[model samples]
Target: MRAIMGLDPVGAITRSVEAFLVALLMVFAVACEQAKLPNLLLISLDTVRADHCSAYGYGRSTTPVLEALSAEGIVCDAAYSVSPITAPSHATLFTGLMPQTHGLRVNGERLSDFGLTLAERLTAAGYQTAGVAGSFVLNRTFGLDRGFEFWDDYFPAEGSKHPSSEWMGHEVPAGFDRRADQTTEIAADFLRDSRDPDRPFFLFVHYFEPHGPYVPPDRWRKDFPCDQGSSELESMVSAYDAGLAFTDDEVGRLLKVLDEMGSTEDTIVIVTADHGEGLMTHGAMAHGQHLYDEAVRIPLMFRWPNRLAEGRKLAPAVSLADLAPTILELLGINEGAQEMDGRSFAPWLLSPSVEGVTFPVFMFRGKVRRAVVEKRWIEGERFGVLDGQWKFLTSESEEDELFDLEADPKERMNLASSYPQEVERLELLLNPWVRMKSPTDGSGITLSLEERQILEALGYGF
Candidate 1:
C-alpha cells in the first residue's frame, strides 16, 4: 500500500448523501528512501472545447504543451460538465455534489463554506491549500474560497471597479492575459515557497482567458482563421483557440517550475476546461444556452508521472464534479463526504475495470434542455437515447431534430416526427433528472449599485 503523510488542511472526514460511503484514511509515515509524492495541482481553463485541442483531434495547433503532457497522462475523451454556467458547474466540480443539491443554480449564487470543497477536504487532511483563480465568478465572496491558506483571486478590470449607473454593466478588461499571467506567478510562488516540506499542498489554479471577448495575445492571433466563417460564433471560436494557446504556454511555465522543484515525479497534475464553447452548431450564438455537446463536452487530461499509463483514453461517462472526492481519496483525507455526488476515478487511473460498472451523467442549460449520457449514447427528450452515431432533439419552440452524429456531428436534421416512441422514452428519462435541478437563486449577497450593473453586463439579469 502507498503510505501517505499527515493531513494538513484536511479536517474530519466528510459524509456523502448520495454515495453513502465513507472512505477510511490513515496517515502513514514514509521511509526516507521511498519516493516523495509531488503535490496535487488542479488547473481548470475557462471555456475550451475538447474538440479544439490537438491532443483531442483538433486540426489546429492549439495545444502543443498539453499534447506533450498527455504522453504520460490519462485522458477522458468523453468527459462532460453537468451544468453549462460557471457557478453551478464549478459547484458540482468542487463539492462532488449535484448542482440541485448544492443549491447554487445561478451565476450570481455562491457555494456554502459549510460545504466540503476539494480545497476544504484536502486542507483538513493536513495538506496546505491555496487558490489562484482568474475570474470574479470564482471569488471568495461566493464561498469558493473556503479552505485555502492563501486565496489571491483578483478579478480582471473588474477587480475593484463595480458597475456605475453610467457604464453599460461592465467592460471586458482589455488585457485579460496580462492579469492571468500574474495569477501564474502567484501559483508558482505558492508551489515553490509557501509549501511546507512536512506537508503536501492542493493548489487550484484557474485561468479565465478563453472565456469571452474573443481577444488573444497578438503573436497567436492568426493561429485560427477569421475566415472560418463571418458569423459571430465562428469568430468567437477563433478567438477562444488563440486564448487557449496563450493559456497552454502558462501551463508550460508551471510545469517547468514543478520540474525545477523536483516535484514532477510524484505530483498529480490535471488540465481541463469547465465546459465547451458553442460554434453555432445548433443555431446558438453562445454557450450556457444549450445542452448540446458544444456546451457540455470539454477536454479532461490527468498527468501523473508513471502512476498512469500514457496515451490511454477512458471511454466512460465522467463528470468534472467527480474531481473533488477522487483527489481526497488519493491524499488520505477520507472523511467529510456526507453529500458527494461524484465517484472517484483513482482506481480506474491505476488499472482498467470490467464493463458492468458504468455511471450516468446529466447536463443542463437553463430550463431549456437536459441530457442523460451513458457509455454509448447521449439522449435528449426528442429522440430519446442517441448513439454517437445519431443525435436527436425536440421542443415546442421547435419541432424535432435528428441527425446522424457519425455524419452530422454538427447536428443538422429533424427526425422527431418519425420517431415518437423513442422521443417519449427519452423524455421520460430526462424529466426526472430535470426535476432534480435546484431552481435558480440569485447570489445571496446584496450588491452595491455598481455590482448590480456589472452583473447585467456579464449576461446576468438584464
Candidate 2:
C-alpha cells in the first residue's frame, strides 16, 4: 500500500489496531468491575418511630443495634414514609412510587401489578431474591412477593395455641403475624443455607413489632417497667419501647448471620421502617389515622463498608419512595429510575458534604371512620405536602392546617389561619400531587374471610 504523508500505511494501521485493543480491554475491565454487585440486606422494622430509637437520640437504649449500624453507616435524619399504613408505605418503598400510583391505599389492600418492585429489579439484574415477612399483611397473597424467589409468609393456624407470655394479652391473632425472633430465625436460615453461594442476593427481612398492642417478650418488657398506677397509655408506651428493644436484638442476630457467612463487608445493609407509630401524638393510639411526624417519620440507615462513608448523617428529608431508585442507582442500574417518583440520594452519600438540601415529601392518608383533624373529629381524605420548613395539611371536610416544622417539630400549632399566604403557597404544591391518577383503579384483590378476620384483628378493619 502507498504511504500517506510520507508515513508507512502498514505502521499506521498497526498502531491504530493496538490503540483500539487497549480501549476495548479498558472497557472490558470496567464492565467486569461493575458486574461485581454487592449483596443487599434490607431490614424493615414495622411501626418503629424514628424518635424512639436510641440512634435517633431517644433517652432509652431502645435500638442499640441501630445505633451501632449508624456509627458505621449513613443515617438519614429526616426520612418519612409516603403513607403511614403498612401496605401503602411498603409499596412505595419497594416500587419508588407513591401510594396513589402504586394502588395500595391501606393495610388490607393488595399491591397492584402495574409497578416493578426493588426485588424484581434486583432479580432481573442477576441477584437471588428472598423475603421473610413478619406479618400476614405482607403475605404473598398481597402481591408484595412478586420477585422473591423464596417468600416466607407462613404463619400458624388461627386455632393454634400459644403461651400467654407470647401473646401478652394484646390479642394478636394467632396466624396473623410472627414475632421478631421467629422472623429473624427464618431470615438467618435463609442466609445460612437456602441462598445460593455463587450469586449475589437481595434479602428482605421484615420485623413486625411495636405495631399495636405492644407485646414485648417478658425479658424485654422487664427492662421498661411502668409505675404501679400508671395510666393505660403510659403502660402501653413502656411496652412499645420494650418491643423496640426486642426487635433490635433480633436484628443483631440477623446481622450476626451475615457476619458468619463472611458477607458483611460485601453486602449493603439498610435498616429502616415501613412507617412510624402514632404513639398518642395526635390523640391516636395507633397509626393510619394521621400524617403527624410520629406516624410518618421513620429511621433510615445504610451501611456498606469502604463503599459508602461511615458515620455520616444527611440532613435533608427523603421519602420511602426514594429507596428503590437509590438502591438501583447504587448497583449501577439506571434503566427505569428516571420514571420513579423518588430521586436517588447516592450522589449525596458519595459527596463529602451537601448543604441546604430539602426534598418536598408528599403524604396521603385515606379517610378513616374517625380521624383527628384540626384537633376535632372528621372523616375525609387528608393530603399533606412538606417543602422545607413549612408543612401544610388539607382535608376534604376540614380547614387547612399549616405548621412551621423547623420552629415546632411537634406540629402543635396550626399557622394556616395566621399565615394564610403560606397556606396558599403550600396548597399549590399539594393539590397537583393529590390529583394524580393511580396506575390501577384500586386494590383489585378481594380478601378471603380469614384474611379479613386477620386484618381486623390487626386493627385494619374494612
Candidate 3:
C-alpha cells in the first residue's frame, strides 16, 4: 500500500436544512422515476482563466457554448484550485485530496495508487469509465489512469511522437499534445461505440488548448488580426481567446452527441478548468510560478438540465478537491470504502437558498510557497494576507507592501505601515497553514535520464 503523509485544511459544511433539502430532492428525483444513476461527463479546460470566459463576464465572447450551458446549470463564481500546475491540480480534482496528501505536488510526479480515485469508485460501482486527455501530462504513467477502462493519452496516435529537444527549442524532452478536435473525436467515438447502453458511464475529457504555445486553429487565428503589430501581450491574449473559442466549439460538439444519444437530460455535465493562465497578470506568461488569482482561480460550472437549478450563480470559495466527493454524493454512492478529504457540496446544487459557505482554501506551489485564502483573506508567497479589500504582500527581500484589491486590482497601493495590526492578524493565520507538513517526500524519484530531461524541460527543478 502506498503511504500518505498528512492532511491539509478542507471544507466542511453541516447544515440541517441543506440536508433536508437534499433528501427531499433525492426523493423527488426517485419519484420522477429517473435513471438509477445519471451518466457523468467531466470536461476540463486546461489553462483557462475564469475571467476569460464570457460566462464570467469577460468583455470578449470567448465561451458562447459555455455561456449557454450556464443558463441550464449552476455556475460557481469563485472556484480556486489547489495548485497552478497541470498534474497536481488535476490530481486534487480527481481524488478530492490536496497535493500534500496525494503526493503529486509537482508536474512529473505520479498520484499514489493508494489514494482512491473518483474513476475507481465509479468503476467499482458498475459505471463504464473512460478518459481522453489532450495533454501528455495525464498519461497512465502519472497514476491517474487507474480505473479508466480506456485511457487515451494520444501517444500511440500517428505523428504523436515526443518532440526532440532541438525541435521543441528546449533541452528537455517535450510532450506531444493532441489538439482539442482529436480529443473530442476520440471521446465522441467512445460514446458512440459503447456496447453497454444500460450501464451508466463516466467520461473525462481534457482540453489542452490555450495552455502555452497558445496556437488556435487557423480560422480562430484569423479572428485576431495583428497586422498593425500589436504588443506581444495583445497577441498572446488574442491567441488564447481564439483557442478558447475553438475549445468551446468542440464542447458544443460533445454536448450535441449527448443530446443525440438522448442522454443529455439524464447526464450530469460538469465544465471546469484545472487552472488558469497568467496572461501578464502579476508579470507571468504561464502558470505554476505564482499563487495569484489568475493562476489559482478557475471556472466551475455544472449542468444537469432539469435536475439542478439553472442559471444560478453562487459566490463561495470552492476547491477543486470538492469535485470527486460531490459527484459521489449526487450519484447516491456511499464512499466510506476509503476516507476522502473532500466533502460533498451537493446541497448547493439541490437548493437555491442554500448559499455557498465560506471556507479556507489552501494552496501549495512546490515546497517554496504556500497560501491560505478565504472569502476576503488571501496570503501566499511574497504576497501576504489580502482581507476584505485590503491586501498585504511581502517581497522576496522581506519588504512589506499592501494594496486595496477593490480599488487596485493591479496591486499598486502600499498600505503596510498604514494598517500594521491587520498585517499581524493575517500573518498569525498564515504561519500555521504554511508550516503544515506535506504527506510524502519523494522529490528524489528515480527517473530515467530521458524522463529527467523531460521534467527539466517542463520547468521542474529536478
Candidate 4:
C-alpha cells in the first residue's frame, strides 16, 4: 500500500470516492435545472376581437376551437392590448414594454434590436425559435423579426402594397392564401426539422384572417346571418364571424398536430389577438382611430397540460406585455436573460388568486386620451396610468374623464364633475407614461421615383 503521505491505499481510495460523489451530485443538480425548461408556442390572431370569441362570451360562435383550448386552461377576461396598431402591439407583447418605450409607434416604424425579445431570451436558453408572421408589418423591416433563428415573413404578392388594409377591415390583396397557409407550413416544418438535443422551440405563428372584408370559406359563410339574423353592417359582422370560424378550425388543426406528435403535454400554448374590430362601437367602423373599448380589449388564453389547471379565468387587468414573462416563467428559464416590464402570471395559472398583488394594467392610444372605469383613471398622450375609477387623458388639450366601470361598463357617462379630487391623483401617475415616449424625427425609408409612382397608384407609401 504505497501512499505519497504515510497513509494506507484504502484511505486514499476513500478520499477519492468521496470527491467523486460530490462531483456527481453537482452535475445532477445542473441537469435537473436544465431539464425544467418547458417548450413554448405563442399564437397571434390578426383581427379577432375578444368580444367575438365564445370564451369571452360573444353572441356568435366565432371561436369554437379557441373555446375548446380555453376550456382546458385559463382565460383572461379584462385583457387589453398596449396599443391599437398591429406592429406596435406585437412589439409590446414580445418586449414586455409599451409601444412608446420600444419605439414601434406606428405601422411603418420599428423597435430597435438592442434589447432582448422573448424569443431572444429563449434562444439564449438553448431553445430553437421561429416566427411565421402573416402581415408585412411583422416583417424584419419593422424589427419584429429579431431574435428568431428563422423568420418567414411572406405576404401575398398583391398585398405587398396594402399595408393599411387592417383599417379597411380587409385581408391583404385579393388572393393571398400565402399569409395564413405559408405561416402554418413553415412553422410546422420548423417543428419537424428541429433536432432533439436542442432545447424545445418557441414558435410564434401570426394569422391575418377575420381582419377585414370578413371573407370566410363557403362552408362557414352561411352559418351566421347579418344582425342576429337583419343590415349590410350586420352581414359584415356575420362575415367577420365566418372568418373567425375558419381561424378557429385552423387552430384546431394545429392542436391536433401537437396531439399526434405527443407534444400537447409538453408544450405551453398561448392564443391572443393584437386588437378587436369594432362593429361600430363608439361610432367606429374598425381599429386605429379611437381607443374605444372595441379597439383596446383583446382575448388572451393559455393552455399547458400538467402545467396549469384547466377551466380557470383570471382577472387582474392583464395586458399583452404580461404574456412574455408569464411564458418564460412557466418554461423554467431563469438565466436573468433580460429585464422585461411584464410580470409573470405563472402563480395565477397554478392558483387563481391574484388578490394581494396590485398592478393595474394601463393602456394608451391617440394623441390625448381619457379614463375608463370607476375610481381607476388614466390620462396621457400615448401614455396612461390607471389609478384605482377616475381616468385622465393627456394631450395638448389635457382632458380628463371619470367612469364607474362597475356602474357604467359601457362608459356612457363621465363623472369628472363629482370626483375632482380623484382626477388630480391620477394626473401624477400619467406624467411618467408621457415622459417615457421617445420622440422620433426619423422618416420612412424613402422610395425611388418609380417606386413612389407605383405606391401612389396602389394607395400606399406616400
Candidate 5:
C-alpha cells in the first residue's frame, strides 16, 4: 500500500523528525560557540616608543619578550596615539574615540562619565573586568575606572621613603607611580587567584616605566651602561632603554603566569604603549610637548594563537582609538561601536591581503604652560594629520608644515610650501574633526591638591 502511493506517511514523518533534530543540533552548536568568550589581557607599556623596541627593529634588545610574542602574533608597524599625553591617550584607547570626543585632552584631565569604556562593554557582556594601573594618573578619581570590577591604583602615602637603590638615586614622591614589576605582580595575582576561572575575564595591566626621570634597576643600568664621556642625553637614553628592558622582563613574567594558568592559548594578549617619550627628539626632553613621530607612534601587537594570523606585520597607520572597536569586533560584540570615532581594523587582521590599506591618523597637542613655551619646547596648540605618505601639521601660533613621511621619515624637511594642494586636501579632513564638539563633558571635574601635586611630579603641571 505504501509503494502504491509512492510515499508512506510513517516514513515521511520520520524523515521530517530527523531533519528537525539535525537543525536543532546545528543551532545548539552555534550557541555553544557563541557562549565561549576568550579572556583578554591588555598590557599598556607607558612611554615606550615603537622604534626603541627590539620587535620594531631597534638595535638593542630592549624588548626581547615583545619580539618573541611578535613571532606568533600580528604587529602593527605604524600605530599612533591620538594624544601624546597619558590620560588622553588612554582615554582614547578605552573609549574608541579621539581625545577631542572623549573630552580628556591632557594629563590630569578626567574622562567624562558619559562615554562607555571597553571594560564597561565587556562587563555588560558577562566578562569579569579588572584593572591595575601603574600611575596615579589613572586613579579612579580620574574616571578611567568606571567599568572595572576591581581597580588597583594603590600607591604609598605621600612622604613614604624608599631606598635610593630602588629608584636609582632619584627622589620619587610616594603615591605618584609604581614600578612595572609591582604592577605585574598584582596583575598576575589577579589572573591566578582572584578571577573566577570559569568565567572569561578582561585584565588590564599598565606599566609606567621608561617615562621621565629615567630610573632603571642597578642590574639594567649596568646592562646599558653609558660611557664616562657620554652626554647627558646619551646617559638618559641608556637609562631609558634599561627601563624598557626591565618592563619587558615584567611583561614576560605576567605572560608566564597566564601560561601557568593554562589560559595562554585561549586568551587574547594585546601589548601597546600609551605614548612615546621624546628623548630629545625634536629638541623636547619628554612627551606632552610635541607631535613628532617619536612622541606619537606606539607599539601595537596582538597575539592569539590559531585564531589570528601569525608573524604578520601591517604597514597601515592605525590609531590607539581603534583598539576598543577592534577588540569588540574580534569578540563578536556589536552593540556600542557605532558611536566610536575609530574604525575597526579587525577586517585587516582576518584578511590575507592588506595592500592599498591606508587611513588618516589625526593627532592633537594642547598648549603647554607659558613656562614650557618660554623654554621653546612647543608653541601653542598643534594639530596634525597623517594620510598615506603626507603628514600635514598646522598651528595657530606656528607655521604650517608638511612632510612626505615615506621620503622624509624624520620630518626634518617641510614641504607645506611645495605641496599646497596636499595641505588643502588634508585640511579639509582635519578642520571638521577639530571643530566637532565633544559629546561627553569632563570640564566640571576639578583636580584636588594632592592630584595636582602628583601631576606636577609626572611633569604635567600648568
Candidate 6:
C-alpha cells in the first residue's frame, strides 16, 4: 500500500474482481451442462400389444395418452420382447441379457445377480433408483430388485389375498397385485416426495391393468364395442381395451406429475411393455405361450423433448434387451459395465437411422423352444427363423411349417413341404440357441401353492 510501486491499486482490484466473475461463470456453466443430462422415467405396461395401441394404428383408441406421448417421442414400429411372460422379459429389460445368459427362463424364477442391471450402474453414478412393480411376478423375491434403493413391491394394506377360487388350493402367497391407479399413486408420490431436486433419478413404474382378468372400471368400459356381449372372446377383447384405456390414463397422470416436478422437459421417458397379450390370437388368452407378433411385439416409445425429434417412427427391429445399455450410454456412465448381450441403440435414438446394423434378437422359453428373429418376426410351436419373406418353423408336436410373411400375415398357409431347404437352413441357425440351457434348471423350483395358483391364473400350465 506504500505507493504500491507507483501503480494504481484501483486497476489491480478491478482486474481481480474480473477474474473471480469469470471463474464463477464457468462454475455456473458446468452446473447447467449437468442439468441437461435429464432424469429417466421408465413406464412398463404389462401384457400390452403393439397393434392394440392407437399409436400403432388400431381403430380403437386403446392408448390415446400413449399416442399423444408417441407424437412427442420416437416410436419403434416393430419392437420385440424376449419372453411372452413378465419376469423373464423384465429381467431382459433390466439386465440387457437374454434368457439364456441371465438363466431365468421361467416364471417364479429369480433373476440371477450375475449380470449388472441398469439401476446398479446409475445408482453408482449418484442417481436415486426406485421401482414400483404392479404385479407380484416382479416382486423382490425374484431378485429383480438387486439395484433399486427403494423397491416398492409390497402388497396393498389389505394384504396378499388369493385372487379367486382358481387359486384357493395352492399354497403360494396370495400375491393379488394392486390396480393401475394404486401403482400410479405410488409412482407419483415417489416423484413428488422422495427425489432430491438437484440429483438425477431413475424410476420404473409398471402397470398391470391389461395383463389378465381384464376387469376395467365402469368409467373405462365403453371405449370398446363388442358385437356380441355374451361371447367370451369378444368380451375379453373389449375388457382388454378398456384396461388399456385405464392404464393410459394412469400414464398421463404420471406425466403430469413429472411436469409438476419441473422435470417433464428434462426427463427421458420410455413407454413400453414387458410383453403382449394373446387375446385369442393364437388360441391363448394371456401371455406365456407362443412367440407370435401379438404375444411378443410391444409398443416402444422414447421421449426426450429437447434432445429427440418429435413424431419420428423407426422401422428397424429392436428388442427390449437394448434398454439398459441405451440408458447407460445416453447418460455417459457405461464405463466398467459388464459385456451386455444387446448393443446400445443410442445412436439410432439421436439420429434418424443407423445403417448396416441388423441386431439379432433371440427368444428362449423352457428347454425346448428357441427362436432367432431378425429382419422379420416369425414364431411357431418350437423353433422358427424368418429370412426376408420366408418363415420356417420346426417343432416336435407340430409339423415343420413355412410361410411367406409378406403374403400371409395371418400365417394361414403352411409352405414347409414346399420349401424344405429353407426349413433346414433356418433350423440350422436356431439349433444353437435352442440347445443353450438355462444356467439353473427352473423346472424344480418348488412354488408355494399361492405362487403356483397365480401362475396358473396367468395361463401358465405349471
Clashes of each: 32, 0, 3, 19, 0, 7
TM-scores for every predicted model: 0.75, 0.86, 0.78, 0.80, 0.87, 0.84
Arrange candidates by TM-score, descending: 5, 2, 6, 4, 3, 1
- State the local distance difference test value for candidate 5: 0.84
Top TM-score hit: 5
What is each predicted model's overall lDDT from 0 to 1? Answer: 0.67, 0.83, 0.75, 0.70, 0.84, 0.77
Query: How accurate locally is residue 160 in candidate 2, as Cα lDDT from 0 to 100?
Result: 21
* Model 1 Cα shift for residue 241 (angstroms): 1.5
Residue lDDT tens for model 1, 1-462: 122565533333332422233222212234432434347888888877788888888888888998888877888877888766677777887888766557876566667643577777676667788888777677666777777788876544443223222221333332223344666888899887888888877788888777776677677777777874488666777777888888888888988989999888768898888877776665554566666777778888888876778888887757776777667666545585435666776677778764235554555544434432222222232212233344444443434555555655665555567767656645544444343433334434344565445434422231
Question: Which residue segments of model 3 deviate by more than 4 Å?
Answer: 1-35, 156-162, 165-175, 336-338, 367-407, 410-425, 428-432, 442-462
Q: How far is candidate 4 from the true structure (C-alpha RMSD, Å)?
A: 9.9
- The residue ranges of model 4 lying beyond 4 angstroms of the native Cα positions read 1-34, 158-182, 194-197, 227-229, 335-338, 366-392, 397-399, 439-462
Alpha-carbon shift of residue 241 in model 6 (angstroms): 0.8
Worst 10 residues of 2 by lDDT: 159-168
lDDT of 1: 0.67
Candidate 5 has its poorest 10 consecutive residues by lDDT at 159-168
Cα-based RMSD of the predictions, in order?
A: 13.4, 8.5, 15.0, 9.9, 8.0, 8.4
**Cα misplacement distance, residue 3 of candidate 3 (Å):** 76
Candidate 6 residue 404 C-alpha distance from true site, Å: 3.4
Kindly list the per-residue Cα lDDT of model 5 for residues 1-462, writing each as its tens digit. Answer: 876979789888999999999999999999998779999999999998899999999999999999999998999999998888888888988988887677888776678876699999999999999999988778786899989999998766542222222332333345677887788889989987899976899999999897767888899999998888999899999999999999999999999998898999889999999989888778777888778899999999999988888999988999898899899998989988777878788989878675456778889987676444325534667888898999888877777889999999988898999989999988776765555446666344354565545434422223
Q: What is the Å distance of residue 185 in model 6 from its true position?
A: 0.5
How big is the positional error of residue 100 in model 4, measured in Å on the Cα after superposition?
1.8
lDDT of 6 by residue, 1-462 (tens): 646578877888999999999999999999878755568999999999999998899988888888999899899987888878888899999988778668887777888877688888888888888999987778787899889999998655352323632222323355558788889999988998888776788999998887777778888887676785479888888899999989999999989998887788888999999988888776667776666678787999999987888998887677787778778887877563346666677888898756345544555544324433232233443554445566565656556667787798667688888878877766665565455444456533354565545434422232
Looking at candidate 4, the ten consecutive residues that score lowest on lDDT are 453-462
RMSD of 3: 15.0
Model 3: per-residue Cα lDDT over 60-135, one tens digit each: 8899999999999989987877778889888988888767567887777778864678888898889999999887
